[model samples]
Target: MPIAEVFLGAFLQVLFDRLASHELLKLAQHKGIDALLKNWEKKLTSIDQVLIDAEDRQLTGDRGVKLWLEDLRNLVYDMEDLLDELVTESAKNKSEAEPSKVPFLLPSCCFNLSSRAFMFDRKMRSKMEEMDNRLKDIITRKDIMRLTEYNGQRSAYRPQNLPFPTTHLTEELFIGRENKKMEILELLTGEEDDGTYMDIKKIPIVGMPGLGKTALAQQVFNDDRVANYFDVKAWACVSDDFDVFSITRSILETTNPQLARECKTLNSLQDELTKNLSGKKFLVVLDDLWDKNYENWIFLLKPFRSGVKGSKIIVTTRDREVASMVDAQLITLEVLTLDYCMELFAFHALGVRNFNHHPNLEVLGRKIVEKCKGLPLAVKALAGLLRTTNNPREWEDILNSKIWDIPEDRINVLPALKLSYLHLPSHLKRCFAYCAIFPKDYEIQRDELICWWIAEGLVEAKEAKNQWNAGLNYFNDLVQLILTWGSLRVITVIYL
Candidate 1:
């Protein structure tokens, strides 16, 4: 037998031996419950302070902390066992004396002692839980707080909520995408229905930066068909680190707010998710998935598969590879067409009224919109940045500046985009990073050298604009390559 098992068995044997002897009850009766409890409380306080001091000593490894914690736990267990024995003895004595009703000797008691032990155990357990929670909070804060740098400005110091663009304001705001919406609908409905099991289709929406992939998914998420179809809906922003527990907690909070307190373990989380979703359809949207590992995807999806059928997993990412890796039936989102793009820009900038009637400003507005290309993200970003500005000169300057031409190393947004780029394996890296040179949203023919990439020797083919098959392969391959690489940008997708 394992040493741990042997030791545990021995510990229990010794415990039972002492309990049968009623040693705990005798000690409490001899020493007085109040005095004994006062001593135990002192010991507990001392142990807690010692643990805190040891933590401050900056122990090299967790071994010391683990050992100390284990000792404390063992102490608690022993105390609980002793209390149980005392309670049993007290009950036995009371039963034995019950027949002598005329004497009814005062059942003078270890009741206070037993109560104190129970209270002590409760406090100890609470403290342990609080300590564990504090440690997790520290780790999470370390990870998240690194995202922003303190600039010593009051404006920066202000605690601001996510003020990024929303789906409502964007033109592509579920603008006119029916086919993709239907695909999502089919996954949630259709003949694939299992009586209880939900076939989790992790559909990854992959596209380049500024593509309205997230916007499209968000639209579908809020669609009346989707809302009506899934009985339970939970949305979580799974940024880079992808803490399973945190995400689970967020979903639990969203799906059934009261159960958040009950979710303490992964198993509990799974149980809660299953219990809430059983016999009821559900939709879970994991936005901004950055992790590429199948394990990461599987770990989260495993529980959902057991959910009621027609339950769906929709993930939006810039990396098509992530989509493919997760077996997401790829919904490739392309940049808006010229007409759609112009319409979106006019809607945002001119606010539904036609600005084209104004000769001079119309020309200037068109120039500004053209500079943003057909990319809704960039247009929306520029629009929000310029929303308060009515200055014609500022608009012209923004239009004239080569913001798109900003060097890869200099732009904050470029580096954020590059984070996903840098994480790709070498072969994939060479294929993807090569596409960085293409003008934003430039629709080079699929076979057209993937033009920039071919010249860069990232791919083997030369430009063949007329060969549809070759173009398709090249386009699909490049699309696959980029989507696989993933997007690092943090901007929430919003349609204007």
Candidate 2:
């Protein structure tokens, strides 16, 4: 029970899982309180505006914020129970009116509310009014608590679609990963279908968060020479949530965007994918995968089987269990060596490989890198913030940051991450901040995150771009802010 954020999972389930259901909507309709439900929906949306900020405030041992969060938690749970009751009651009503219509798991005899409709309505309406007042009271305390609503700048984020990854254009950007990238390239191009790849020749680049697994995968993916060996190529960002239909669609979108748009079903998408990949030496990059279900894995590969024997699928994941799912000849990535980490910091900060000239900043920079504990993302984020300045005091200040004082085990996010987060435009900040609620090393699918932002109203929709596209731009901005294969100068992993 993380009083600040863990309850968000339960809150989201109530908001999304139950509230979005047709059964609840039908119940609201029958009670003629659909308008009231919609108003509550708006209230919950308003509550979301302050939650991440409240979570941040709660970390300070702000007793007031903590109390507010506790109150909010109770309210969310009560609302969830109420919604569940409504749906259950609605289902029971349906089962009673048409006895054969009972839902599979729910027994008609299990009814909590009476078959008498007025009794149910009388009890529910009073509860709904109290919840309504509860939500409003929470909303009023929000301003007193100094919760800033994030209505982001729509104009600041204008990035278009995801940048196409290119290895040749970005190969020189890597630091110590050249060897690993070369080794993987050797496997991908070579017929090393040894025990490592098992039967499918899938290479799993397994590592903990921020080790540059995705960056390494990108290097291998964008390698100029890789294009020559594979006849068909596709890259899919398969984060923790495994939706085979979406993944199949993502692969198709890479191979044939027009055809992908035409596809509506898994069967159709896979058929198109199989036809396009048949007899080809394909290279499929499934980046950041977390799912370990064997049946889903097999089902996902139904189209890939059409590709030739030399076909390759590069899977990057944090879970070794995921590697086991693929019977991976695992290429587990470790943190960069301290020297490499320092060099990475220097390269990003001073635009030099080492602190040969600026000896004044070298000591502080090394100390800062040491604090980062060889996490490339941490080092790069800190270094990138200092890219334009060679000031020693600034370096010292960064080295002495309280973020570094947050013991490594206790802090889920890197201190440098907070520094980097501070530099982000307001628009990207809200979306990126929401990500903090996820546990460390949580694998987030790109679109899934974008959709969450849209659903949560974190994305500001303008007439020019709908919420989804606005979210995409927010996502892209945050992606580039952290790591982009094409542009990030220091070292190349965003979510590392």
lDDT of each: 0.51, 0.70
Name the regions of candidate 1 deviating beyond 4 angstroms.
1-179, 192-194, 408-496
lDDT of 1 by residue, 158-228 (tens): 11132334322223334435577677667655635557763565677777767776667777777777777
Query: TM-score for each prediction?
Result: 0.48, 0.58
Predicted candidate 2, C-alpha RMSD: 13.0
Worst 10 residues of 2 by lDDT: 485-494
Stretches of candidate 2 off by over 4 Å are 1-172, 192-199, 423-479, 482-496
lDDT of 1: 0.51
Instruction: Give one digit per residue, the lDDT tens place, for model 2 in 1-496.
Output: 2223423522443354466667677666655577777888787777776665565565445678878888888888798788878777777667554333222223336334355854665677678879989989988888788886645321122333546544323423478788888889988888732222224588999988778887798788878788988777888877777889988998998789999999999899999998988767789989888898999999999888877777899999989999988986899898899999988888878889989999998889888998887778777777777776777766765675444554566655556765465444445655665676565446579888887877665566634358777777676666665453222221111223
